[model samples]
Target chain A: METLLSPVVLFFLLGAMATLIRSDLAIPETIGKAMSLYLMAAIGLKGGVEVSQAGFTPDLVLAALAGLALSFLLPVPVFFLLRSIGRLDGTNAAAVAAHYGSVSVVTFVTGVEVLTGRGMAPAGYMVAVLALMETPAIISGLLLASRSGGQALQARGKLLHETLANGSVVLLVGSFLIGLIAGKPGFEPIAPVFEGAFRGILCLFLLDMGLIAARRLRETRSLTPVLMVLAIVFALMNGLIGVLVGAGLGLDAGSVAALGVLAGSASYIAVPAAMRLALPQADPGLYLGMSLAVTFPFNILIGIPIYAAVAEMVAR
Target chain B: MTSRVANKTRLDILVDRPLLSVVTDILHDTRVTGHTVLPALEGEGAHGPWYEDQISGSQRKVMVICVAEPDTADRVLTLLQPLLDSHGIVVMTSQVGVVRGSKFA
Candidate 1:
């Protein structure tokens, strides 16, 4: 209830409403990109600063391992589901599966905001986990696609570039390193920009997201009722699996929920680019429609709160 | 002014951001004198409406323009032919006059 009413989520709803009504509300493309970059850097720096203060811990290591494992393996089941239940072919199924397996930075950022507001802030090291979880799913998805000979975008040089050297990964990792090096004293000066203005910026970004998502849903011709149901199901099932894994690993309530959020979220940014490049034969309308239009909004409106509640229950 | 300009082939490509490199490499491989890449804002196609989505970049597109000799343009076309249907790449070639056709060659 709190999250749904919050200005961040409300702005998102407003954006969607504006688009749905054809009110011509739009955020410029460059501005939207800039906001996303800023959010990534802020998340990274804050995580790094917190980690620097807390230093290394066993839980952090465990979280990282679990995150990597989940990212690498989650796509397998998703591929099968997409193939059988979703009635998609090998290449398309593999493409969509990669998206479900990967984490959404925006979704994680929103989850952290809600969790923090609820007074259950996840450990800072989870940012590292967030970064780690971004790319390995691409490897899994590609392997699945290649079995069906969807290897158009399989040049290792290009794959490495897309995975490691993409703008988001670089900004997140670089900002984290800067924060780790600077520590508390170094962070004090930039606190106003990064810490003070964080929520407002997030609200603006989510507004753009809402606009993009709603507009996409309206424009897409590829999504069906069954596929839409599968999108929600993937989020819930994967989220539950994430919570279970996090709890088994002895993560805190916040971290466990954060894991659920990450697990539940689908990658619209990084994975789509990779899939488009690697699986050009795959339908962008299907993958993009599922991830950006359906799953993204669902996760924002319902999935986050559900994961938070589950984390609370499991933690107790 | 018309007579002052020499005859050349103008090649324009509407390409997704991811494959911009592949197209440009074809340009390089075909040895087009030079090409300019521009961001495409919003457009509709057989797929649907698309805009310059920088975040996901799947919907984003670029317009690559090159003025080249006819032979060079033909070579570029042949190289990119395989990707046209599969990649949704659209290439347009038109005959145009340039002030420096020598430069294009």
Candidate 2:
């Protein structure tokens, strides 16, 4: 209930409702994009500062390795399930699976905000975890596509390039490195721009996102019950895995919830673009609608609280 | 003072990177011998302005232009319509005065 009433949630709701009502409300495209970049940089710098304070630890490396493994491995099952149950073709399955294997930075950022609101914070090194998880899922999705047939092999070069050079991966990892090199003094100079302005920018971005989501939902009428069930189940299972991993790493309830949110979220920005390049035959409507319209809203509105409760139980 | 000349066909297509091959394959199937591709920086769509930094590294839009005979354009557009139905594509056909009608045809 408290989570539902948070300023972030309320703002998101306000934006969504306003957009749905066809209000003349919008954020300029460039401003929305700049906000996204600023948010990424701010989080990366904060994570770096925290990492600086904590120093190098074995747990950090282990967590990163585990995250990579999960990213690479999770998509295989998801691909098969989408193919068999959802009746999606090879391209669509691969595209959707890649999304499941990847993480959403926005969700991770929201998790951090939630934790902060509750007076609990995770180690800044988790930003590294977020960055590490971005690319492996793409590689996994590509591998799944290749295994489907020989025709996909011809596009291997393009696939590899897209996966490696994807935007989210570049910004997240690049900003993290910048934070690490700059440390505290460096972060302080830019804090006013990146940190202070983040919340206001995020509100604007969320407004744009709300409009995008509503439009997608309006266009998609064929997202059947079976797929909806699958989306919900996968989201729940994904969150559970994150909770377990966070607990094993000795994270508290709030931190565990944050990790869960990170794991459960799917990429609309990065993976969809890569899929368009790597899996042209794939139905964008199916995967894009699923990720952006279905999974994203579920995680933001409902999954966060459920994860938090689960984390509390486990911690207790 | 304008004289009627043989009309040549022009085709323009805009697509994402993944579908580039599929589009090329359509061209190949239609026996298109030559074409030019230009990169799109960014633009708005049903989803909004697809930022280059959002998805794949290339984050580019490609515009494929081909000038061919009327018969070839008709065949190519028929094949292309479905592939591009869910995706973004623009096809335009305009009459061009061919100086060397035999070679173009």
Candidate 3:
């Protein structure tokens, strides 16, 4: 309840309600973009600082491997589920599955904040884990969509390039490295913008996110109820699986929660760009609606607490 | 003094940003010498409305404009029609007059 009532989540709720009730409130495009960049940089920098203090360890390696395996393997089940139970074609199923398999940075950030608010700090190396998990599902998705042979093979090179060059990946990884090099000395100069005002900026960003999500929900006419239910189911199952893996690997409580969040959260940014190039025939309405509209809001409101609890239980 | 003008076809294609390269490549292959691509701020279509600054490039739209001779325009249009049908793209062509026809070569 406390987590739900946090200022950030409240702002998100406010934005969502305003949109649902047809209010004219909106965050300007440039402002929203600036906030997004700020948040990504702040989180990356913090991660870098943490990593600098801790240095590379065997646990970090294990976490990265777990993230990669989760990213690459999760989609196979999702693809089959969508094909058989959801009754979607290969292209649409693969597209949706790719989304489920990849991580949502916003959700990851929010989960970290929630855990931190409770006095548990996740490992800084989790940021590297986040970056590593972005692309493999795209490869799996394309292969599934291609089946025998087609344009998929020819476009693989270009799609790989596009995926790597996505702005989100560049910003997160670049900011992390900058943070690593800058170390403790560098954090002082930028503390005013990146550290002091981090939460306020996140509030404003989530407000905008809420508005956009509500709009997307309205725009989604193509999703069936079965698929809708599966959105929640996928998050639950994937999140549990991720937490189990993290606990099994002997990670701390906070890092375990972060892992759960990453596994549960679907990609709305990087995967979508890759899919646009690799699976052009797939409907954006279905994948975007499921990821942005359904899964995003769910994780924000309900999934975070449950995952945190599960993480605590496993750590205990 | 009057400026010299010659007939040409102005091809405009609105496509998702990720596919802009593929569209431009088709123009290159179809013998279009020059083209300009502009980012679209916002618009509504079959997939509903979208904005350029939505923080996701997958659904963001870009407008590709090129002036070409009729033959080149026809070839580009024929090739892109299938893509337009499959993807969320809008393609249109209008007759226009260019100052120097050779410049579009």
Q: Which is the leading candidate under lDDT?
A: 1
lDDT of 2 by residue, A1-316 (tens): 7877876766777777776788878665566677777788788878887787778787678667767887787788888998899987776778788998888777778777776776666667889988888878887887787777613633567667867886667887888888788888888888888788877776666666666666566666547778877777777888888877877777666667777777787877777777776666666667777777778777878887787778877853
Q: Give DockQ per model, in order.
A: 0.85, 0.23, 0.70
lDDT of 1 by residue, B33-59 (tens): 799999998899998888888989976
Instruction: Kindly list the per-residue Cα lDDT of model 3 for residues A1-316, writing each as its tens digit.
Output: 9999999899999999999999999888778878888888898998888898889899999999999999998998998899999999888999999998899988998898898998776899999999988888888788787872424543667887888887788989999898889888988898888889998889999999999888888767778999889888889889888999999999999999899999999999899888888888888889988898889999999998888999998884
Please state the Cα-based DockQ of model 3 relative to the true two-chain complex.
0.70
Candidate 2's displacement at residue A296, Å, is 0.7
**Stretches > 4 Å off in candidate 2:** A146-154, A252-254, B1-9, B17-90, B97-105
Please report the candidate that would top DockQ against the real structure: 1
Residue-level error in angstroms, candidate 2, position A140: 2.1
Model 2 TM-score, all chains together: 0.82
What is the per-residue lDDT of model 1 for residues A208-277, given as tens digits with 9 covering 90 to 100? 9999999999989999898999999999999989998999888999999999999999999988888777
Worst 10 residues of 3 chain A by lDDT: A148-157
Candidate lDDT scores, in order, read: 0.90, 0.74, 0.87
